[model samples]
Target chain A: MSDSPITSGMTGKTFRVGDFLLKEWEPGEEERIVAAFNRVFAKADPNFRPRSLDFWRWQYLDNPSGKLLIHAEAPDGSVAAHHGFINQRLLLEGRPSLCGQMVDSMVDPAYRRGLQRVSLSATLSNSFIGHTGGEGARLHAFYWGAPVPVAMRIGKALVQYEVVRTQLKLSCAPAEVRLQGASGISVEEPASFPEDTVEFFRKVAHCYKAIAVRDQPQLDWRFVRHPECRFSIATARLGGELRGYAVYSHGSFDGFEEGLVCDWLVHPDDGAAANALWAWLVEKARASSAERLTAVFPETVPDWIRFQEAGFRAAPTQYPFVARTCVRRFDPPWLRRNWYYTLGDTDLV
Target chain B: MHSRHPPPSRTLAIEIRPLQKGDEASLLEALNAHRGGCVQQGHALSSEELAWFLAHPSGTRTLLAWEEKEIVGHLSAARHTMWMKGRQVLFAELLGGFVAISHRARLGKRGLFARLCREFFSEQGIDGDFIYYGWPTREEWRLGRKLLAYETIRTQVALTLSVGNAAEGLPAEVELMERFDHQARWLWDRCAAKFGASAIRDEGFLNHRFVERPGYDYENFGVRDDDGVLRGYAVFRKGQWGEETKGLICDWLVPTDEPEVGRLLLRALEAHGRTQGVQQLFCLLPEWSPWFDSFQRAGFLATDAERMWIARTSARRFDVFWLRTQWFSTLADTLIV
Candidate 1:
């Protein structure tokens, strides 16, 4: 047995797991990559530590949307590690949230000689001929804990940290949604949101200093999926062309602090118009036996104020943060200027 | 990889027997019999905890040991089926995993495991593809290394938060109203216009949470401007309450710009008990929410927080679609940490 970490290489190269050629994994290697990763995991943790093989498969390789599985191989061409995303999805409300999940990512430690980087991008193309594919994927965040600290002199990372608590509080009132007032305002069933509303939102604030959401698909996908939400919509016609409208979504939280107004929005900052619309809807919720209103408000906006005035309180959720560095050498000079492609991205990615 | 092979020194026998209809009395007697007897140290589980463990779906596997005619040791485990990794997968956990001291040196663990694995565990598996991942977390790392045949995967934290009643569930100023077809519709619209059309409350989504609708207290409330303009509103639905009909704040909205307005609405909510005739408010706070601090400042005591992880059976990125259910969170309304 060799005492050194380096094993022998073949093909005029030093990296080898016996005799197969070593190469960066690509799309065609999905099955081999997934197999290798799972094999390595099976050889490591079998108590479902981070996830089970089934979990990694579904989340990465077997995803209904299809994915690319990256693999590192031995000189003999045996697969080593299965690393990378299963598929990409969107997170509405803000940011074009592209996501990449590491699945069955492992290495055959005995075969280690260098080269542990493995990746697999899904089917989406970044460019075909001369067109952009709007790729929404990233390989930055990882599931395991953070990197091994920068210095051994840092005293082995001694910090008396405490465990953060999480709770879900329910309102004591019956959540029966009822409206009690009779307003002269004509009510039309809320329609698929029009672009003007986003435009109106732009008028007040610049989309929270993130990527400008200047389209329809993103809006429809985000707010539409959570259907149980109740919405109050009022249309104000201006010269036969609808200029401004108010939209309120019925949202709730169970098991947090109390069910809250999860989301609400009124176009046209005119306090009177939005207020009138708010009054009508609040009366309805009051009549409907609602305990409280719920909304997802950003740090910016009158939402925090408006939500409170509407008889709702704020609640919070916390997620443990862990980070690691994969690149042996890192530099971001190229990404500095392309705000959209560089630093201007969402966490889901 | 080097494999460690130990010569077989002991034979293990495990017997799975159905619980007799009148096993309680016998079980109680057995427990009492062991009370004075020398059992393994640090191996005692409270009767209540044991009962709770046996009540869940996961606590199904129980193995009794017998040498000749005397019952010496036992092993207990659970079998559960749930939505994991985006699909349904069966999970087996070794809980209350114990063995008799006398049987320890004789390969008791290996025997019990081999027998159990023969009964409930399977080696062949596929998650769209063959995966052999492992980890080295302080808790589960040993098993993977012990198995020797497995590989290391990633490690993560499993988290949770509990839901319960506040010291006061409802506000004293709360009043319940009926859903006005047009007004509720208008509020829904305003919310949609302001938030987006996708936010309006609907039956399918609401009903998915619990069994019924219109069954909660503090059904709804409205805060209007002095001039009769709708300024704020909240809706409550019934849910798992530590006390009476819990107000699940389904929705809250106001047309102002101050965090205090949210506080005022919270104050109004705290006073709404008179209307609902109940004593609590409840809701779940996801880790991604921004108002966790606000709820704390407003006097809502937190119950617990736990890490969150998901099991996927397919190849798809996890965004918000994975709403995982977790248990045993230390969340309370008042705890600051």
Candidate 2:
């Protein structure tokens, strides 16, 4: 467990877990990792796709936030388990901080029994965040959405992980949507996130203890330039200054058409702007013949009140956002009150 | 307006019988007159709406007590089905049980309400194996417990959060759907096994309970992975629960196998709630619900008052602990809350 630099070409630190060896991913392990991922997940899901090296490279090597890839090697030199974290810049209490999102986690079925699964997971996580200096020292937290039950249990019991919030689904019938537009605001579906929109987000970022930096470039990369999924961006301006913006897409579910609001941001003080943006979206969805419109938000989010007034209902499905951090202290009530999240921040869509 | 026939005299003998097709007028009059009861306090239903209630999909049968042609007492038996263990069990919910204030004393000695309960239970038995349940007032609950061996399972409490100032949001990547899909059905299959007892949340049940519900409009939100596999789903509506203007989380399912899905979906709901301008977000979860931790983490505080989830099982045994943990009852499941 050395705090040594882990570069693509150089062999980094390694740990022994039972007879298996856990080490940082090297330069040429994409094929082995992909093969092991496909093999493990194919058993769980018959339709699981075999990811290509390009997709892997796009997600890992090309990510703006640096990637931390760890794999457990068996005696045969095949990958037994894989765990990775993609770096993200976050505003923690209005100050810039480094965080990571845990992703691409899997273990070979052969070595998943007893404590090996737990050991491999813990060893990899510890190696990434446990180092004392350099890049590891700069890491404040690692957050992820929707860990399977077993992972949640193990992380809570063994790793002191805490759940940040439970995601709740809410929906509204397009035919029943009613909203009073704000007189000062004008809304338009923009082709990209404008600079004013980014500035508006920055103005409101301090309202939450933690949030992703939603600048123009990040927004462009996330919603506009995403490889899969096409999102429609709507921006609301008051006197030509960006007050709020929303991202959504139209799709059908179970034979019923719907507009899914993927992401949204409104100034904490701009109730009128939020209303105008919502009214415009509902009207847009109705114009497109979507039977209903839906969005996902945390239950504690105050903005949900506006959606409810606009006729949205809470759905029964929910997801949990969990976090594990050594440097950040999340006071339960405060964390519950201030953390801002949206359907757009995760990889589920 | 011209006066109708005078009110029934005290000496008139009361006769109880199955409600006939022409009873809608009399039933509406009786319901409107009894404004003290919970059902009567809400907006009065029109004749068309009354007919819709009597013609509920699962089927509803009302038995009325008449005093020389004047309807004096009324009770309804609404049939339903619930998932117990892994099977659908026939169930019935009693609704609109009441007697005229002047006729109450005489009817008690004759056991009018008790007799109606007996007949309804017997009728359910003749139809199929059934569990008779209801949300009776405290007085009625006591009477039923003494007379029909009704058992109080667990009291369901309303959890509320003043979300007016909370600043949480939904994860942007998780997809929020407004309709049920194959992925939702898949998620239900993956998530349903953890519950000890619940309504069958399959596509048929969802379509009937939410999509096809009369009067109120409901929407379903489905969360899926990138591969289009369902992780969880929720049913919600915007309406008043008692006096509060609230967004109700009627029913939701995220697999205990994937608690993180529950977190993400719940957060998404909160964000939706903010945009809707509800005074509060309300959810009905049993104290022992596995999702209670998630709800609490999202800042939902439980109110001091609770509603009883009472039932009369065919086995004639009351296992309160099992009912507390196994029974997945929400406000949406009740005939009237």
Candidate 3:
């Protein structure tokens, strides 16, 4: 395995289990990886939307915070199993720590059963965790992800995945909504996030116990610079200072045309900014002709209650939020009570 | 994606059988000796409470694992009638399962505990409606899912509000009742009509759960309409859990369309709870319940309870997805409060 720490002179070792070769992903293999991902996921889920090569490169190869990709190769040199992690900056108690969000885990159907007793998926996951997870790993401090149901089961039994919370889908009818005007707040659809957005997030970061870094650079990479999908960025300002912002997009979720709140951040005490951004979102959804508007916010987020008050009905979804700590252990109760996340934190949007 | 393998063929010298007459005292002694002999590690049921725990209105059955003449493990399944999709169905609530600490280590996958669960579900399965449900602690939740084939429905949280100094005015139409009367049935009928699934909270269940419990005291409040008929009701218990002295809303029922009645009941409970030296009130109702929004409108916020609802079922209609989306439950439906 290459690109990982050497233990007992194992670096650059060509590890082989029977006919399958386990190794770290190399450059110039984006096309094969993307094709394998599309083929494997489509076989697993009929409704799975295939990813383009450009989308794959932007997501895993070109991420600003670096990438963690490991794969198992079949005898014929096709990618059999691949596990990728996207490095992220997480603010915990106002201290920035590097974290990884697991994404794009797939195994080729033909090689699902490996030569040895261990499965290809398990071999890839074990290698990924051994190299990237635990206390001494320099790659990231911890990892978290929203896994599908089958993966959730296997991860819990094998890789120490603890469920933080099940994601809730809050939906509201967009039509016939009356928008109230905020007295002094102004909302604008900016082409890109302003540089001051980083400072704005820093000013309000201490208000939350745990949150992803939602500064300008991260937001720009996640929403504005994505290869596919377009998001509307609405920034609310009071007297020309950034008070809050909301990013939303219209899409089909479960075959229903709905509006999605990908990311929302407002100062905890600034009700005016929140109200203004919410009004802007309602108008945006109405103009786009979306029948329903939806948002995914953990109960710990302050806006969860506000969304309910704004007539969004919360219901449990199949998606689950799971976390694994490498350097330190976080109590599930404490994490559930304080961790703030939105759909943008996930790869869903 | 491994295939399911059969349990180990090796067997210990343990016999699984149902509890016969005159076995209550021995079961109680064994459970009390180990402290929380039940699988959940809750308070051991007393002699009288044991009878009440096993005496469900629908029916009750207990299976015990025996090594020689000694009871090494036990599991109880109690039948409960609930309204599911507007029709009555009987489901089993698996409870009071505990294994002797000395025997647990030897039980393994083919041990006495696993054998007891297999027999319990086999005897009381989804055939006639034996859908099973239980509120399990973290340890039991893990083991139940692994061995007993339990699926999580949803993790429930508690809605809490601080009882402040400002006194709330109770509606004149509301009255605190000594016991639930026949009008309570009408109130439950109206409330049940609007729910996807709920326990049968008729007059008998109301009295059995709140008024007639042996060791606990609960205050029942009822609200009336202009016609002097009962329109809503709420059961509150001023209890201390750990260090917090709080008011617990054990059960509540009001028609979904009648928000005023719900608000009035909340005001009456808050005023009453404050007088009893409670600084906060806690209610455990599903977010899907219409009354949950009513509680939120009255200033209650959802907080973590560190508990989850899990069930083992052969019935397809009561799958995890449907339960998570449509089921409406309360603290009264569980043994938590």
Candidate 4:
């Protein structure tokens, strides 16, 4: 009944159960949370992939020490419910302030009746979900649903709110194409990428507010972090002015044709530039012997138009999923969806 | 309104207004007051996270409704850059929206949302090229797709894995780094060198961000060829947000592009979890990513994956031709097209 030292083998106790009492998630539980998260997302994701537990560790717990946590307990104190509140700051409508995100709420539904302790853990997570509701219980899992109504309400009230919108788009797949040699447009792959490509991207990123631009750090992290993408940069020039560019990458991934066009780019408006660049890309992609373009962002980028118009039809978009978080909200909003192609989870700038 | 389901006459007053830093305390307080009814969503506010939220740019400019200044309802519209058909477009997102318990049915929130939308579009020199939004429910998808000037709306799902299962016999060819020792650290640089410059390839980066970062274990494994040359590597770790430990196969690099190799990497993970005391594991892959095929083969039942939304921005409005043709050779020839 109290936050007292839980004794082992205790019965008739409503909530308390040994050291592993149900409590909201907090900063220190990052490891435990990551451990449980592996189980949580297995059923939800096909790849059940993780870029790095450290990335998540920093994102969910270490970074967002700002978030609150809660968990369920057992008689001898084993974590039955690793459930709780997650809070973080995010930009809203061009304004910066604390934006509550509802995330990481789970219950072993099969053991739903094991103990009211689970319910107690659900309430514990809500302790912070009511973040904006100051003096309220934490919200459980608002963006996503919760196991119980009580938990759901807690999660709901804490979130910034649900925006009823759909912005996800499907990318078209590549079609059979033949590249013809074009004149005047010197389209040659750079022998070596400009060292400043990352810097160039940093400056170029300010152009889109719809998506977050990749800072030098993020670029370095993704492209430098992994070697999955075979990235190369190309440019078109006239009158000594840079007219357009393409940063394409070819990579091999499982579950698809051997080689894939991981990335391709063409400006949204400049037809000639876009055309030249795309033709070059098609020719180049063909040269790579790529059966598919896996690294492509469907409609997320304006270049998608050139890709589709040239015959790339709908190939299922890669690694799709909903974004939910009340925990570990990143500062500065690095992972902007708008310019995802350039975002470069890999292949560098 | 078009599709009526249940709960005759929803009752909360849904107001939307610009949220300020000071609003965190009272907003959370009000939410706590309605703790029982508010259970369907969110974690309650805390002082520390509240301060952090206020400090982040995304948390700024959010609109909060006043139930007499009690912080009953809210709609946070976070703006960011995105790629739309290959050009930069400033996207105004409707994120983190919520209504107070008493403000439901009054259309307070919708009205406020509409007002924000109109004002945003109408602003003089608004400095944005496009707008888009992502939603959690069908009603949401329908609303944004129908009312807004967006071209496409896609499905989103989430996938989970339970580490409780025994995944034995995953080829143990890959070895997890014991610690970020000099040898291990040297491999990181060698692995990073393949990407070359323009990459944030640095020992400090890996050490700080992944290897030594708190809450993350550097269970980085690498497979060697006959010569013991590291040909493939996978950095798998447990990611935690709340309660469950999620076994995430975060990054994997292989010398072989074989399906068997991919399967083997997964097998290595399956084997890894068993020894690490992992009860279950799941990683959210990009929903449409074929990479998940391996996970499915490995028996991870995927579900609940959500859509990934993006907004892109560029200094100059994204001009597709400029973006594409600059790279596409025919684009130059097709100045005529």
**Local distance difference test, per candidate?**
0.34, 0.65, 0.74, 0.41
Model 2: per-residue lDDT, tens digit, A1-349? Answer: 0112223211357887777787877789888998898888889888788877777776666554456778888889999888766555567777655555666788787876625356666665666566521223245455454554456556655445555543445677776666765888888888898876556777888777878777776677678877657888888888898888998878643234578788889876688888887887787787777777887666556666556656675543334456665554443223455667776776655
lDDT of 3 at B221: 88
lDDT of 4 by residue, B138-225 (tens): 3343334323333222233233456555547557665666433334344434433322111121333334334643333557666665
Give TM per candidate.
Answer: 0.30, 0.51, 0.76, 0.34
List the DockQ of the predictions in order. Answer: 0.06, 0.02, 0.21, 0.05
Model 4 TM-score (2 dp): 0.34
Count of steric clashes across candidates, in order: 211, 75, 1, 259
Cα deviation at B162, candidate 4, in Å, is: 51
Best by TM-score: 3
Off by over 4 Å in 2: A1-12, A16-19, A113-118, A132-137, A148-161, A251-257, A287-289, A331-333, B1-337
Task: Please identify model 4 stretches exceeding 4 Å from their true place.
Answer: A1-31, A38-207, A227-267, A270-288, A294-301, A315-349, B1-337
Reference-based lDDT, residue B262, model 3: 85
Clashes of 3: 1
Sort candidate 1 into its docking category: incorrect
Query: Per-residue lDDT for A118-205 in model 3, tens only?
Result: 7677766676565565433234556788887777767765566666676667677775333455779999999999888988988888
Which window of ten consecutive residues has the lowest lDDT sum in model 1 chain B? B328-337
Task: Give interface RMSD (Å), model 4.
Answer: 13.3
Q: How much DockQ does model 3 earn? A: 0.21
* Per-residue accuracy of model 3 over B1-337 as CA lDDT, tens digit each: 7659854553558888878888888888877765654323346668877676666566666888777777888887666677888677767666747888867775567777888888877765444445788776655665665578776666656778889898666667679888888888788787776677778887777777788776778999888877878988888998754357689988888888888888888888898888887988988787667676667657776655556676666766666656666666776775445
Task: Tell me the TM-score of chain B in each candidate.
Answer: 0.36, 0.80, 0.89, 0.48
